[model samples]
Target: MQIAIDGPAGAGKSTIAKMIAADYGIIYLDTGAMYRCIAHRVLLQGDDFSDTEKIIKLAQEAEIRFEGEKVFCNGEDVTESIRTPLVSLHTSDVACIKEVRELLVAQQKKIAGDQSVIMDGRDIGSVVLPEAEYKFFLDADVTERAIRRKKELDAKGIEKELASIKQEIQQRDDNDRNRVEGPLVQVEDAIVVDTTGKSIDEVCAAIKKYIDEVRA
Candidate 1:
């Protein structure tokens, strides 16, 4: 079975994806993290986003691996390093590059083959796993999503204003939805779930109800 969850950031896609993967004993592939790995690599090599050649070469060479929830880039463990605010801000810059997306999408598809996998990202349903048995588009109000992102940064002791977070989320939406390759999209067949004003368990239960009925 394959489950594809696509959503803008901070819609609880990652958290809920982890839960669903655990419940089903399947692999939880964090596709966003793969992009973040390349972003983090570019940052280390000089924090240059305009250098598409360098970025593409890095993508071609990056060895991204997931052991449990940790992510490794090349030979180093970048699990927490890639989650820093700076890396988060630059991830989409690299993701929008067509070559980078193709490189990473191939890895994502290979990882999902012949396995019970739950993958979450901007374009999983539309590009990475169109044949997935179950697909969902999770969305929430922009302000609600920004508030969620603020709390996450706060927990990590990274102080960021709520307004700034909201602005970043908006920009990311524009980029993801407008990108030329592997753009973020909701397939017509995908089940749409608005997570606004809903608790994680509530959202999970609602999605599982649909999946369970079909399975039974």
Candidate 2:
């Protein structure tokens, strides 16, 4: 059984997907991190982010491996490196490219094939795993999602202005929604979950309820 959770930035899809995967005793896949891993490599090489060809080469040539929650790129541990604010900002540009999406989406599908996995990303429901046994579209308003991002960064000691974070989030949304291939959109049968005012447990319960209904 595969579950695809689609959401914009900071909509809690990653957190919820990890939790749901743990509860259901399945592997969890974070497709966004795959792009971030490539971005981290590009940045490490001091390559320009807007150079789509370089980015695609880096993505295709780089060795990205996920061991449980840790991510390794090019045999180097980058689980923590890719989560930086710099990587977050640059990855959006890399991810919006058609070639990058095609390469990574193919790899994502291969990783989740024949596994009981819970995957989360902007295009999971619409592209990466459209035939997943269960699917969800998670969303929250901009301001609310920005606040959540601020809190997360603060916890990591990454000082960032809320306004700047909000602006970056908007830019990411625009880039993802307007991308030529596999743009972010809800799958037809996915249940939309507004996560603005919901607790983690509540969201998990709602998803569990949906899973139960689907399996019934």
Candidate 3:
């Protein structure tokens, strides 16, 4: 069965999706990392973000792959490189491009066909895998999400103030919601999980409960 988890930044979509995939022994796809990899490539080439054609070409020509927990681009391990704040900003821009979304959505679909997979991203449930047997939309308050994001960046030694992180996340949410191609939205059939004060295990267990009900 295919599982699609969609959520905004720092909403714990990735963590929960990874947990589900591992527990079920299925493939886990991080669709956001694909866009980040393209953004990283664009930055390396010193290309302008407004250059949509160039960005689309770069996305098409670049080879992006996931090996275990590592992300590779054109035979290089760029797992850490793609997570930089600069790439995070550019990724929002790249993800808005129509061609970029089309290319990545196709890739995601191909990888998921006839396979049990858990995929997470801003548009996974709303756009990429609408027919997924199980779908979830995770969300948290802005302050809570900012705190979670700050903790993540701190672990990476990338420091930013709480206010700045919250503003950046708000901008990202606006961009994702207003993007022309595959805008981020919660599908009607998806189960919404508000994770504002919940622990990761609590969130995972809630989702797993639903999955278990469906399986039974």
Candidate 4:
């Protein structure tokens, strides 16, 4: 009963995933947060994102855990820590490393193997959960995505310019799509949902209806 949701940043992957998982009484795994946990670890040590060995070593020893909506790394709660803009910037660097992806992907597979899980990430459908019973690709206009991100940060009282946020998201898209290890891609069988002007509930309903119709 595993479900995979893949998408670029700010496409409402996490929010919608959590909703669907809750509706189905399944575990929702935020796979991007796993990579961000490793990035946060490296940033805590230094700003050398280019050091592949250091990043891989940090990843090798990392213990990422998910308890409901919170993320824990090495027994420490990093739910809020890993969501920082800084960690978001460096997450791609860690995710690009071959060894790091293998380690995290194995953990992701193991988690799914243990239960019926709903996982979301850039590469989940393509790599981590290729055999998932359901796969969805959510996408939206880049500007719309950036606006969503700005609202999130603003709600958190973290100020950031919209233009800069848009640029940062663009960079993330490029990196995610171009990365060699586990690139962001829409699998052929994945149901594509354009969320450019849709509300979260709208998208969720659309997905549920699609899945339910097929199952029926």
Reference-based TM-score of each model: 0.98, 0.96, 0.98, 0.98
Clash list (residue pairs), candidate 2: none
lDDT tens string, model 2, 68-151?
A: 889888888888888988888888788888888999999889989888899998889889988998989999999999999999
Off by over 4 Å in 3: none
Full-model lDDT for every candidate: 0.93, 0.89, 0.92, 0.93
Q: Report the poorest 10 consecutive residues by lDDT, candidate 2.
A: 47-56
lDDT of 4 by residue, 69-175 (tens): 88889999999889888999889989999999999999999989969999999989889999888999999999999999999889988999999999999999999
Model 4 per-residue lDDT at 67? 87
| lDDT per residue (tens digit) for residues 46-136 in model 3 | 9589888999999999898999999999999999999887888778899999899999999999999898999999888878888899999
Task: For residues 1-216, write the lDDT of model 1, one tens digit per residue.
Answer: 999999998899999999988888999999999999999999999988999999999999999999999899888999999998888889999999999999999889998889889999999999999999899999999999999999999998999999999999998899889989888899998999999999999999988899999899
Off by over 4 Å in 1: none
**Model 2 misplaced stretches (Cα beyond 4 Å):** none
Q: Clash pairs of candidate 3? A: none
